[model samples]
Target: MAMDSRRTHRESAVVVGGGISGLLAARELAMKGLRVTLVEKRSHLGGAVGAHEVDGHVLDSGAESFATRTSDVAELLTELGIEDKICSPYDGGSWLYLQDGAHPAPRTGILGIPGDLSDPSIREILSSAGLRRAKMDKLLPASVGANAKTLGELVRKRMGQQVVDRLVAPVTTGVQSTHPDEVEIESVIPGLQAALAQRGSLAAASASLRAASPAGSQVAGLVGGMNQLSEALVRDVLRRRVRILTGYDAIAVDRDPDRGGWTLLQRAPQLGERVAPVHGKYLVMATDAPTTLRILGSHLDASTIPQVKAGHEIALVTLAIEQPELDSRPRGTGLLVSDQVATVRAKALTHATAKWKWIAEEMGPGKHVVRLSYGRGNDHGPLREVSLYDDQLITLAMHDAGKLLGVSITRGNLLGADVVRWKGSLPTMRPGHREKVQQFRNSLQDLEGVTAVGAWLSGNGLAAVTADTRRTMHEFIDATSAD
Candidate 1:
């Protein structure tokens, strides 16, 4: 081991980034008997799927659920021996807070797109004129918006602007952290284009997609928290004898001419820390888009590299309120605020205790945990108008929660509160994002023993990320083994 100071680590991998993807990549390499050294800039791992303690209860600080469109996350959980922990949120449903008032979210739909146009909730959200306009989607030619690049265009052209503005915009922005105009329809809603063509109508196509999807809740969570997946991944990778270095930021990457591998220059998060060099036969850049591109740009043509802009900066305020009124789940699981709602600054709110039965049982009676998310797809959202300090943000959360949920949650009722902010954690997959990522990956072909994988390449959600990371690892393994 000491001799590695002079020579490159032969038959080894150096994975930069300790997120779920990086950890999975390291595990895959380790399973193949390749020595793995994973480096993370943060002191703790898990990246966005992290955990925090609020009022003595440890909960997921980032992503709390995974889409059930695919079994990728479920399979991974099963592999990690946590299959029995899978649980769906209570079937109480969710709500959308608009300028007028709170309305029940449309059922039988995906991403707030109502598959059943006759749903009462859908009618309530759209005006009579708006509903008439939306009905024209059935009469319009399927080709009207079939080739539309953005989700906004497709929905607007076929289903009317009201559908896009009232229905799709809030859900898309809240979930993807980006505007529908910037989102690629194919990437976000796979097979939607073909479905539209086949069904000859937008509503029918949405219904077809929903029908084909796995029955039951569209999302699922672990018994403990979604962060358990990260914990399980770290444990499995460690068991595989993978080496993990925390608080180590990779500053530069270079191709080792002598060994025909790769070498990485790393530094600690703290200033004046000593620099360290790591080398391996295989290199995985699993950080955010900008950081990954920065490291790989050293070996590839900088001009051809796609510049992935920083995503929305989100600040989450979790409030542990002693409110018995929320026991009935006033707004169901929570509410997604519409952009037109000038009264509320928070974009979304999750009644944690109401959403997850396990959390409710853990907290006991008369106590509730509410989480409010402050941020929007665009930079000019309400979050920008408010200050982000812990006290200030919590004050805003308390105010918004009371209004959105139709309950009174004063500072006296606030038992415990904390603010968690994620900067550039979400990747904005705008139209043509897939192509740009492909071009970036292709640009790395000339550089041997290197590959990149993350949410930037895969679309949003745990399913896309988990599936893509494993697939990339297999590809890398096969390509290298062939050599």
Candidate 2:
């Protein structure tokens, strides 16, 4: 492919999403000397990584931490001059709410897969029969689950239905926002399948991955909150003179027929505002999969549009309460609930104060911040009804929090509360999603100036998005600069 010979002023790029990925993309392009423009439909810049205030104290309403599996997020923070503020979660362990009761989550595994089955805590969650079945993974043939596509199929073949339902399902739902049966093993845990083939067992493979992971905590957050990363990124991008447009929803995208660049059509923010055509030499689509595909599909082949499942709508309720009983942190950090647990409608609960010492210190003694997340995988069942109203959701959250934490949190104890609903913020990676995403990327080979980057293309979470966005932007920069 070659650039149009008659073109002029080709050193410009337009980013279509203002989340972390989009912000990072703009920063990279600006560093490469390309004037950049970023557009976000929401008035806010950080999509899921935004802040909210409760009782005069500011806190993160969505993601609070980033995985330390990779150094991308930390490296980015360091570049932005806020790495000193990075902090780790308190040593208190997390818990899992099972059908029988709450039990300590497995300490030495990825996504709830136990590395060492001999741990005494394993017995508390798995029955004697279940433990016996799980131990069979070591005895099973290495090829048993090696070819399985989904995480559920692989785990179920090597371990058992009990392990999949009780252990893996909850972790997947809580972390990836999808069932193990739906998510691809390659997408979630990249090296597990190959490690299984080499180590001869899922348990040993998990141990291998955990051993390879960075020491200290698997996740870390800023002293204030994860939202600070977004704030810092936005500040840096603007300092670089990147033009940011909020409340402008992109409706269509196509290659510029007149000049061989790219053109985007954004819907006006208000009734009286006029819609304008934004033109750039390069384009980056960082929105969710559906919206990204809808725009890109206009220029690509029909086969290139992946048949992906729409992301689930998640509602988070953060409560500020005065509970002395929770000061000791009985549940530690919070609990991930098994879908089979009939007592609660919320998928997971985060003891925000217990998880971060900074948050606890800011709130003073006896004050706590607890957040309950509603919605898991594709099913909404109880959550669909409860999430319809803020009061209904908050009331349910109070009851569920009390039950999960084993402490009383009542309206009388509640000092302040907030509810934030995120629709299509987190992608649900289905089976073969990894391959489909790769194919979608390949579909854009003809349009060398356009790139797609986000959680939908990269695997979910801050680590994946950060690392993938940098690589994507670098590739585009290298290719275009060569011209």
Candidate 3:
């Protein structure tokens, strides 16, 4: 139970947190010929991008897909020899559930901001008045919403409040677990404002960004699941001789004055267990925003700590049911429910079997995989519905799924179900969040061998995290080489 007298003194890099970013950082450091030690608080390696089993099927408990905005994730997969495994989702396009009813979502859009207001699908979700106002974006100069901070403001100024409420709200709430109002425009969709300035319209900017994507869907997934990336990274890091410590939480960090590096005080999750300090030439705090700030707060000046907003507490309820009617894939990929739809408590639903061909083939006939997500960033009151018991949550998910899917799915048709909860896993990128992150990183310059990386620093999504972590690690490696 006592701390080990002998500390691990080595010329190494220490990565706290075993999420995708931490694993990638460790792998990069190890590949650069540096001894690395990865400490994970959880017993498992992957943090949000992890897997859970249900009815003999291994499903992604967290992120199942990665944004294709950049080739970073694909490149990493190729390095792991799984590039060929990258697969696109079904082309059936998702739907939007509004207060009125369900309608097809815009086919060519970025985060529910329709690139082409003329599209029939867009018209279906918007009223004649709403459409008229949205089309004004083309006539109104780019300067209209150019200075807008939040995505909601940008869309509202250029498009209409209808677009923000019916379209953008559903996507942002479903995808980011936060409303578009709180999401920083640039953080979620980079270069959008510049594109808006150049193209002279928000719709045109959305169209341009979509056109520039990798010639297919804006997102893609591994054939098995995104969790494979974590598995592959673990294997790669192990092969590179990286020492991995699971069930160990890095409670505090300090400068290793004698070693001229950093010292991490690690403790087992259990109350009375502690471990010897881990000393390394470099330290990467790759945990979530709160945990990272909590540990690094003591080391850094108070002014250096950014006031990061707390993330949403999300619960994903995945249901495996014997619904023969779902064979038709009625809802397309699934539906993003608008917050205005008081009938449904869920923010989104993914018809997994319909979206992924592999999942359908694996499940066979009359079987379907439906996932419903609960909780949003703006939920008020003390008792959240997602905090309910597993069985109760599953019942709610089934009822909500029935409403969203326009079908009658009951417990009689249920084969299996599981609920996965994530607290503060998805970071909320408020307006000026990027600037705050930059300032915090700038402050870290005073502390040698100390850096941070994660979704909190990088925007949400696997691509951003992968790209940002690799860049940070490379910079760290370059700095070390120079010294």
Off by over 4 Å in 3: 1-10, 214-216
State the TM-score for model 3.
Answer: 0.96
Whole-model Cα lDDT of every candidate shown, in order: 0.86, 0.87, 0.88
- Model 1 residue 148 CA deviation in Å: 0.4
Write candidate 2's Cα lDDT for 1-483 as tens digits: 323323454377899999989999999988766778999988898778989999889999888999998899999999999999999988888899988889988888778888989989888888899999999999999999988989999989988988899889999898778889988898889899999999999999998898877334789999989889999999999998999988888989877888768999998767455677888989999899889989988788888779987778888999999998989999989999998988887899999999998999999999999999987766756547335799988999999999999888899999999999988877778887888888889888777689999998887889999999999888777777677
Q: Report the lDDT tens digits of candidate 1 across residue range 1-483.
A: 221223354378899999888998998888777889999998778778989999999988999999888889999999999999999999888899888999988867677777888988888899999999988988999899977999999998998899888888888877777778888987788889998999999888888887766334778998899999999999999998899998887899887889767889999757678799998978999889889887887678877799777777889999998999888898889888888888998888999899998999999999999999987867664448334678998898999999999999898998898899988778888888888988887787777778888888887779999999999888877877776
Q: RMSD, each candidate, Å?
A: 3.2, 2.5, 4.0
Runs in model 2 lying further than 4 Å from the true structure: 1-10, 214-216, 271-273, 380-386
Output the lDDT of residue 189, model 3: 92
Task: Count clashes in each candidate, considering only residues at least 3 apart in sequence or on different chains.
Answer: 0, 0, 0
Which order, best to worst by lDDT?
3, 2, 1
lDDT for model 3: 0.88
